[model samples]
Structure formats: structure tokens, C-alpha cells
Target chain A: MTLALYVPRQSAVHRVPAGGKLLALAVLAVVLFAVPTLPVAAAGLLGVLLVGLGAARLPAASLARQARTVRWWLAGLFVFHALFSDLPTAAVTVLRLLALVLAAAVVTATTRVTEMVAVIEWLCAPLRVFGVRPARIGLVIAMALRFIPVLAERADRIREAQAARGGSARGLRGVRTTVTPLLVQLLQMAHTISEALDARGADDEPPARGRRSPVTAA
Target chain B: MKTKDLAYIALFAAIIAVLGTLPAVNIGPVPITAQTLGVMLAGGVLGARRGFLAVLLFLVLVAIGLPLLSSGAGGLAVFAGATAGYLYSWPVAAFVIGWLTERVWSRYTVVWGVLINVLGGMVVIYLIGVPVLAAVANLSLWEAIVSGAWPFLPGDAAKAFIAAAIADQVRRSYPVIERPQRELAGR
Candidate 1:
């Protein structure tokens, strides 16, 4: 069973409203883009990472688990940048990237998926005037959250099945084999879901019911 | 939320995190990740509201600094990178996917769902991502689309079809929790 990276801690950071966190993220994103100085960006990134570590109370093991997948990419980027760009610029760029990723992960790990939905609903409330239904919007958000892990698991299963059937997805060839099965499985899965929704009468509702929300309240 | 629902959310989130662990297709500008497949499934299965919520959950974790993206990419800085537009569009794409899927509820046909997924999810991503790519990467719109949006189209289409099929199967086999109104209406 694939485990969500959400740590489920009752930290103050977790309690912070999703809207506020989003706003902060936006501000930081702006800062990251606006600032041109490598030193300043690096410093900002470090500060963000420090705050994220403190807020999430992340353990060494969890942190390692999180970083395990990206290490190779990071290494590749470092080497590529080092060879191409000046060392200082590459270091700064890499650090900025790492800091941003860490900050977002902290938000996801600490906050409940439901709360995130609530926040999105709240954010989209303003679109109601344009005919958006917050309830429907919330439903969409909830489903997206739910499906992430499901598809992930299914992809893994398909890959394993293909491998068992003498498919050697060992390198580049393996990559192609893995992707093809995953796609095929996904197509098959979508057909099954559409039929189920039809049986459940999902299509009877009017499209106007899905109008954009107008109020963006906190 | 009920325990079951919570369990469902946890399960999906885990799926997303695991997908994040997989190797990404590093084409230029933006790498294709399996997480988008997760995003598409969220919409196909959960309808509009819940599907978008799920993407928000994934984004929140990314905001809080967890490396929950393909190639383990996360952090506030990612929001400024070339792929930010695509990453940011996940929630909206899910919403669009769900809304469209809900529109074509024709008895679990994978093709219909795949059509909706592509039209709603992938199209919306490009609509939002292309301009953002232009601005962030300092390229023209055409150049950005060619570089950022064009490369991912094939992979995204595959994901859309897959999500549609999975959703169809789930609907057929599983006993979904029906909304009270739908139950009352007996449709």
C-alpha cells in the first residue's frame, strides 16, 4: 500500500489557514522570481527551508524518504549546471529550487486533504456570481485528492504485471514498456469509471449548476 | 469527513507520492510526471468538487516544502520555475476534468471519459501553462508552446485515457457513496 507523505501532525503550521499559506507561497514565489541576486535568493531559500523544517517537525527518515526520489535529478542538475553555468549561479539556482520544493512539501505533509478542499471552496466562492457552484467545486477538489494515490498504485501494478510477463523494462526500453502498460491500464480504468457514473446518474444535472464561483472570502 | 473518506484521501495521496518517486521524462522546460495521471483520476472518479480538492491537497503539501512532485521537486521556488504553470493548473484541470466527465455520463465508456479528460485537463493545462511558460522562460508564446506544451501532449493524452478507463472500471465494480439527493431522486 502506498502511504501518503502527509505526516498528520497537529502543528501550529498545520492549523494555519490554507488561504494564508497560499498567500504566503505566492509572496515567496514572487520574491523568488523578483530577486536577481544569488546571495539574496540563497539566503531566502535557506530561511524558508529552516521554517519549513521547524513547522513540519520533519523527521530524518521522512525527509530522507522524500528526498530519495529526487536525489538523482538534483545531482544531474548540479552536474549539468556546474558544467554549463558558473558555479555560483548553478549553486544558487539549485538551492532556490530545493528550498521551494521543501516549502511546498511541508504544506502538503502537514495539512489535511479535506482542509485543502475547504480552502479551495472558500477561494472559489467568489466565482459564484459567474454561476460557479462551490459545492461542486469542492467535490472536484476532493476527487482529485483521492485519485492521486489510486492511479499511482495502479500504475505500479501494471508495471509489475508487464515485467512478470517477460517485459524487460530495464533501462530506456524498460521505461517505454512501463509507460505503455500504465497508459493502457489508465484507459481501461477510465472506461469503467464513466460507466459507473452513468449508472449513478451523474449526467442528469444541468451544466449551469457548475458556474464559476464569484466570492473569494477568507 | 468520514473515516472511509479519510482513508481514501490518504490512499490517493500516497499514490501521488509514490508516483512522484518514479523517473520523469525530462524533455526540455518541463518534465512529464505520473502525478498528472493521479490528477486526472481524481477528476474522473470524484466528480468536480472533490477532484479539485484532491489536487489542492497535493499542492498544499508541495507548498509546505515536501518533495512530493516528479523527480522529488517541491518548494515555493517551484512555483517560479518553468513547470509552475502546469503544477499550479492541477486543481483547475481536475475541476475541468470532473465537470466534463459529469457532462458525458454515458454508462462508463472509457472513450468519452478520455475525451473529456483531454479536452478539460490537458487543454486547460496548456491554456494556462503556455503563457506562464512564455513569461517565466522569456520565450515567445509560440516558442513556449513548442518547447513546454507540445512535448507533454502525447504523455498527457495517454494519462487522460488511462484515467478515464480506471474511473469507468471503478464505477462499474465498486459501490460508490451516492449523494443523498441522487439517492432520493432514484436516478
Candidate 2:
């Protein structure tokens, strides 16, 4: 659950707004797709390294680890292309992937989850026109994040109960038995949580005014 | 949405995340996961709008760097990869499944549920996902279909049946979806 890879550092990259970093990453993807040349891809890779290591002052290991994790996928992608296309095309594809992966790593490493979520809230602000409430969106997202572990724990309990019955929790039967109970439990819990929300005056509250999380209840 | 509506959607999103994190059912070398099944169940159980929003919220969490994807990978980088097509199709697929499920609510049976799941979860997913896979992975459409679409067909079919069965059970035990609100083609 501790999925945020943000490494606290004192650098200008850390100071850049999360929205800007996300926008840049998106533009980089479009650029790589549009150019589709080895030089541009290679330069993209180089620029990512420079910004990540030199300017951001992130450890080389951090970026290298991201690349290493995707090494097999990169190799397979290259091989797949080489088999169907040409060597240079494979090179560009792999390089393009590497650049995108590292660029994302750089952004993830530099920005906090809260900052990224704030950016998300800001982006969703325009969706308010369709009777969509941005504040409710934030609250629901936070609630989902908060409840994932609770549901996983409950799933474990259901599996254990099935195992106690000498039932296999591996095949389709296992899935049905396990998930149905899990889902039933979830619905019951949802009922309670909604009651809690009403009890706490959640409906009457204004959209969250700032970075404070709206979902304070467990 | 009411507080109950928000809770149901959020909880359904959590269920999808839980399914993604759980171990997959390995039929062969490839693992057949129930995360997609969760998508179908969300639509089947929650109806079109709420079901659509549940899956959308899950993706939003994924985009915001939660490790909710089956591969445990997250963040904006995944949006650029070859698998982006499948990722993009999820919310739409859920919506389609939910929309179909809502329409057939009056005559809803496990049989109808399976058909809706197959139409939305399998056919619709591949319809939108395969071409993007071909374009991004630089494979021919045939290659993409064979590699991207074929291996999962059997497993997905099985999942379709299972999802339909589970939805029927939920409908009987603790039905969350309301009666069909609109006529077919109304929305």
C-alpha cells in the first residue's frame, strides 16, 4: 500500500508543481510517438537522465532500478519488433519505452502523492459542469484508498474460513465462494459507512476547501 | 449522489483494487485474474452510472500512482505503454456492461448476465483494445488479436459465466442496483 515512490530531496525538480511535471510527461509521450526516430528517442533518454540525475539530483540507482524492473519487457519488446520490423525500429521502440519509464520515475520520485492528488482534483474541477462534484470525487477517492486494505483483510478472513471447510481457494469455486462473501461483507459495510457519513453531516459539508482529506472516518 | 451512493461506488472501487492485488488463477503460464471480473460485477451490481463511476474512480487512483494495476505498476507512464489500450478500455467496458445489465434488469438471469458480460467485458474490450495494441506494439492487427486477444478468450469466457453467476447471487441476496430507470436507448 505504501506505493508512493517519492524520494524527499532538496532540488528544483521537487519545487516544480506536480501538474507541470505531469503535463511534461504527457508532452514527452506525444513527442516520442510523433518523432519515432532513434536520435530523438536517444536524446529523450539522455535528457531524462540529465534532468533526473543532474538537475533533480536523484540517485542514479533510483532511475536505474526503474529501467531494470522493465528490462525483460524492454528486451521482449525489442525482440518482438526485430522479428516483425527492423533492428533500428526495435532500438527506437526500446529507447522510447526506456525514456518514458524513466521520465515517469523521475516525476514519481519528485512529487508526493498528496501533491499528485491535488493536481487531480484541480484537473477534475472542470467536470463540475456535468453535475459532477469535484469535492465528492476527492472524498470518494480517499475513501477507496482508505478501504482497500480493509477489504483485503476481509478477503483474507473469508479465504481462511473456506480453508477451514477443507475447500480449495484456488479455482473457480474458490473465487466464487471467496468473492461472494467478500462482496456481501462489503455491501453491509457500505451501508454502515453511509450511515456514518449521514451521522457526521458529510452531505451538508462544503467541498473540501484545501489539502485536508475529506474522508476522516474509518 | 447521496452518501450511500458515494459509499457504494467507493467500496466497489476498493473491491477492484483488492482483486488486482490477490493472486491470479493460473490456468497456464499466463495468470487469469479476476480484476476484470470485478469490473463486470461492478456494472452488474451497481448499474450503469454508478458502475461506470466505480471503474473510473479506480483508474483515477491508478493514474494518481496507486499500485492498483494487476502488475502492481501505476502512474502516468503506464498510460503511454502498449497496454494503454486495455487500460483505456476498462471504464468504457464497465459502462457498457452496466448499461446492458440495467436494461435487462427486468428479465435478468444468469444467462442474460453472461451475454452482457461477454459483449461488454470481452468483445467490447478487445474491440477497443486490439487496434491500439497493434498500433502501439507495431504488430499487425492479426498478430495483435492472436497474441493480445486469443489467449484470454477462454479464460475471459469462464470469467464471464462466473461474473454473471455472482451478479445473480448478489441480486438475490443484497441487490444494490435499482429497477431499470430508463428505457433502452433513452440515455
Candidate 3:
């Protein structure tokens, strides 16, 4: 349920402003994907690894853990390209993907969720001029981030409960059975949350523009 | 927006992200993921606007480098990759699904739910994803079709069915579909 990639540490990567890190990540991604060649990808990979390990002070395992999920994809990508195209193209593609993932890992590991939310809110503040409530938007995003782990845990519980009932979520039927109960519970949870928010007057719109009606003023 | 609407938006976005954490079903280039099911549910249960907002929120986070996508990949870099078209189609997919659901709410049935999900979630998404993938990866359209759409048809059908079943059942029980007060008053 936890954000497995994030490990709190005091280092230069962690100290960098979230906006700056995000900007750097964007630039890094553009450069890697734009001119993707084997040597260029290799250089990008090395650069990301150096920043991840040295600047972020993240353990090698953290990087490995993030890469672990994509290990099969990398292999599959290579095979697909080798058969369809050539080894160099495959290698370059894999390297580019790895470099991007590693760079992302560094950013996520260093930046706290709250800091990320704040940065998002700050970035979206300009939309307030168009009657968009950046604060509300930010809060919704923050809430979503916070609930991800909780719901994931809930899913685990649902699966375990199904297992206890001698049900294995194996094939198509199993998926239906497992998903039905999970969605029911999730919807129920949503209803309860909305009710609680309503009880707290969350739906109450503020007084409109602080303007008195002409009739009332007269 | 009401707090309840905000709550729904946030919860559905979280649900999508949670689904992303599930182990991806590795296909050749694009992986089969539960996140699309989350997208369907967001639309079917939350109605169109909220569903769109929820997905947009998730995408914004992903754009900011959140590793919330399947296989822990995120950031603007992904926008340049082969799967970017699929990623970009999600919000529109959710919106279409939700909009259809909202329009058919009074006469909703499981059949309609399945149809809507398939139409919006699978067909709509594939419409956008295949060509973009071909362009990005420099493959022929036929090759892109082979890689992007053909392999996942059965699984996606099942996902659409399940998403519809759950959404329909939830609607039957909770009835969270938003109706404007003026519409209700007119009725």
C-alpha cells in the first residue's frame, strides 16, 4: 500500500524544489526520447543512475525494485524489435525506456507527496482567473493520492476474503466474482464518504460575490 | 463543485491509480491493465463531467512524474513513447462512457452498460491509440493494429463486461448519478 519507491533522505535531489526537479525530469525525458540512439540512451541511463544513487542517496535496491516491474517489458521489447527490426533499434528502445523510468524513480523518491501537491496547486493557480478553483483542484488531487494506498489495502482484503470463501480470482469467472464484491464495497465506501462530507457542509456554496440584491438594498 | 462531487472525483482517481499498482499483464508493447476498468467505472458511476475530471486529475499527476501508471512508469517522457496515444485517450474515454451512462440512466440495464463500456472504453480508446502508436513507433498501421488492438480484444471485452456489471449494480443500489436541480424541478 505504501509508495514503495519513496525513501525519505536529506540530499541534494531531495533538497531541490519540486518544480525544479519536475522541470529537469521533463527536459531529461525530451532529450532522451528525441535523439534516442544506443550511446545517447546509455549516457542518459548513466546520468540518471548517478543522480539517483549519488544525489538522491537512494539505495540501489530502490532503483532495482522500480525496474523490476518493467524487466519483462524490456525483454519483450527487445525480442519484438529483433524479430521485426534489428538489435540496435531494440537496444536503443529499451535503453530509452529504462533511462526514463530511472529518472522518474529519482524524482518520485526524492519528492514527498505533500510537496508534489503543493507544486501542482501552485502550477494550477493561474486557472483561478477562469473561475477554476485551484485550491479545490489541488485538494481533490491530494485526496486521490492519499486514498490510493487505502483502496489497494482494501482490494487485498477483498481478495483474501474471496480466497477464504474457497474462491480464487483465476480466470474470467473469477475476475467477475472478485471484481463484483470489490466494486460494491468501493461504491459503498464512496457513498459513506460523500455523506460525511455533506454532513460537514462540504457541499454548501459560499455566498455569491458578497453582493446584496437590489430589492434587499432598496 | 460540491464536496461530494470532489470526493467522488478524488476517490475514482485514486481507484484508477490503485488499479495501476496491480501487476501489469505484459503484452508485446502495451500491457493489459486494470486502470482502464477504473476509467470505465469512473464514467459509469460518476457521470460525465466528474468522470472526465477524475481522469484529467490522474493524468495531470502522471504528467508531473508520478509513477502511478502500470509498471511504475510516468513523467512527460512517456508522452513520447509508443503507448502515449492510449494514455491520452483515457480522459476522453471516461467522459464518453460517463456521458452515455448519464443519458441512459433512467432506462439503464446491464446490456446497455456493457455496450456503453465497450463502445466508450475499448472502441474509442483503440481508435485513438492505434494510429498514434504506428506514427510514434514507425510501424505500419496493420502492424500497429496487430500489436495494439488484436491481442487485447477478448480481455478488453471481459473488462468492459465486468466494469458494466459493477457499474450498473452500483447505480441500481446507490444511484449517485448527478442530476441538475433545474432538471429535477422541470421533471
Candidate 4:
């Protein structure tokens, strides 16, 4: 079975504040890219992998699974450098990429979506002075997070339908065949949802703006 | 904005994320994914402001460490990568598409939608994505163009056609734009 990015567990990594974790990730990246040595990057990759699997208590295989997706790109980078530059440079570059990817995975696996949303809302509070509403923006993000899994399930069903009809195409044609119908269904769903929202007066702006207070009107 | 508008933005953002999950067709370093079609639809149907907001919301989520990007990658590191230009181009791309769609409302034909998607969604994004990718990947400009833009042209054309058709069908079936207040009051 394909491993999920997040594994729900009680661990220190999970307990760390989202902001702190994000900060650590940024610092790690700065160090890795600033010092582009093979040994340095290799060390960083080893430390990140170890922390993900050990400190975070993530399953070793699951952590490795994240690396599996980028193996091809790493291989390509290796070949590119090998042909143009040198093997040492190629090794350092791939390691650098892998370290960054693993570090990101660690953050995602540990942090909850809600926590991140909270941090985002807090950060965006300053925009209120500019007449921006952070709460509404936060709601949009929360809703998007909630619907991602639902839509992914819908896509699977669409692909299944295509396969049943023996109409599945490969490569770019496959994207066209799958995406067209998927967009239609999603847009239709959005239509229904918008109607529900409007019926509940979700689109209405309060008429209180620009109105005088009771004392002023008197 | 109304709750309906917020819902639309959130729904489109989710659509972008869901599109990312589909396996990418590897053309070169930058694989072709279905997410850009979502970007096109967001602009074509939602109008400019909401479309831009929807994409902005997606990008923010990507920045804050959501594994919503193609290939299950996310966080600030992505902003420093070869694809960084493409990542950063999404909002402007959506805005342009929506702006074009709104101005040409009288003639909101499939042709118009296709043109907007190509010019705004594909071309604008590539103009930014190619150079940034070249700089980060250390490739020459011509090599970057060959590797990044050339193979995707035909697929993007197909995407543009289908995105326009889908948007046209959506507009006909369900009116997304707000009606005049008098018309609403009469109803």
C-alpha cells in the first residue's frame, strides 16, 4: 500500500508548534543550500532521515517512501551532472534535493492542518488594517483542506468509469480524457454548493456599513 | 464577499489540490499535471477577483507545508526550487485569465476561453517558469525552453480547448456571475 504523508500519532514532532517546525525547516534549508558540499549535504540528508524516522517516530519505510517519488528526478540530475560536470557534484546536488524533500515531509507528517491554519490566520491579522478579512481567508483554506480527500475519491471513481468502458488513454491524452469529465462534475457540484450558500444568505453583505449610530441619528 | 463566493473560492482551491494527485506525465524535469486545468476553470467561471483569491489560497497552503503540490511535495523549499517560477506564476496567471473573461462577457465563447487559457494560463506561466527554472537548474535559456516549454505546447493546447469547453458548459448550465440588483429584486 502507498504510504500517506501524515501518520496520526502522539509524538514530540506532532506536539511541536507549527510555527517552530516551519522555522526549523527554513533554517535547515538555508544551511543545506548555503554550503553546497557533498559531505555537508549527505550529512544533512542522513540527519533529516534519521530525525524523521527516529525523533518523529515515523516508520522508516514510510519516510523512505517519500524519497521514492523523486528517485527519477534525482537520477536525471545525476546523469545530467555526470555528463556535464562531475560525479561528486551530481551526488551533492541529489543529496541536497533529497534532504530538503525529507525535511518537508517531516513537517507535513507532524503538523496538523488546523494548526497551520491558525498560524496563517495569526500572521494575516495585520492585513485587517488594509480592509482584508483574515477569518474569511482562513475559512476558505479550511474548506479546501476538507474537500481535498473528497475530490480525490471522486477522481478515482471517474477513472474507474473510464477503465470500465475501456476508454482509458495514456500520457497527455489520458489527462484530457479524465480531466474534461472531472471538471464538468466538479463545476456542477460547485453550482449546487453555491446555490445552497446563496439560499442561506451566505453572499449577503451586512447593510450596517456607512449607517449612522442610534445616538447620531437622533 | 458573500458566503457563496467564499465557497466558490474554497471549492476551486480544493479542485486544484485534487488535480495535483493524478499521476503526472513525465515530459522532462517538469511533468504535465491536471492542476493547470483547474487553474483555467477557476478563472473562467469565478471571475477575476475570486479566481485570483482561490489560487492565492492554494499557494499559501502550499507554502505553509501542505502536501498539496504535484508529487506530494510542499513547503517553503518548493519556492526555492527549479519549478519556483511556475509556482509563483499561478496567481498572476489566474488573474489575467479572469480579467480577460470578464471584459469579453458579451462574447464569452469557447474560443475566448481557449484564448485566455493559452495566453494567460499557459504562456504567462511559461514566460516566468522557464527562466527561473533555467537559472535554478543551471541550464541555458534555449535548453530550458526546449526542455520545459516545447513538449508541453500540444498538451496545453488540448487542455485549453477542453478547459474552455468545460467553462462554457458550466456558464450555460449555472450562472456564476451575479445578476443586477434590480433583476434580483424583481425575482
State the displacement of the C-alpha of residue A178, model 1, in Å, after optimal TM-score superposition. Answer: 11
In terms of docking quality, model 4 is acceptable
Best prediction by DockQ: 3
Best-to-worst order by DockQ is 3, 2, 4, 1
Could you give me the TM-score of model 4 versus the true structure? 0.74
Which lDDT tens digits does candidate 3 get at residues A1-218?
34534689989889999889989988877787679788999999999999999877899998897787568867876787888889999898788778887887788788887777788889888997998776677667777776776887787887788789896777656645666656667667766776886797656654466487888778
Model 3 segments beyond 4 Å from truth?
Answer: A4-9, A34-46, A58-102, A160-167, A171-177, A190-218, B23-29, B138-147, B179-187
Local distance difference test, each candidate: 0.67, 0.80, 0.82, 0.77
TM per model?
0.59, 0.70, 0.79, 0.74
Query: What's the lDDT for residue A79 in model 3?
Result: 85
The residue-by-residue lDDT of candidate 2 on B1-187, one tens digit each, is 8988889998989888877765554332123577888888889999888988999899887675554666444556567777788878878888999989888887889999999999999998888878988998889999888877888998899889989988988888888887754653476
Q: Interface root-mean-square deviation for each candidate? A: 9.0, 4.0, 2.9, 3.9
On residues B130-184, what C-alpha lDDT tens digit does candidate 1 reach at each position?
A: 8998998999999998998888878888788777767776666552324446545
Backbone clashes, candidate 3: 0
Please give the interface root mean square deviation for model 4, in Å.
Answer: 3.9
Q: In order, what fnat does every candidate score?
A: 0.15, 0.58, 0.66, 0.49
Q: Per-residue lDDT of A1-218 in model 1, one digit per residue for the tens?
A: 12245777767887788767766765665676567568877887777666667765766566555455356777777776788777876676677666655556565666676776687688778997997666555654455455565775676677678778877555435434454445445444544554564576543454464464565321
Clashing pairs in 2: none
Segments of candidate 4 deviating more than 4 angstroms: A1-10, A29-45, A58-102, A169-181, A187-218, B23-33, B71-73, B130-151, B179-187
As a whole number from 0 to 100, the lDDT of residue A95 in candidate 3 is: 86
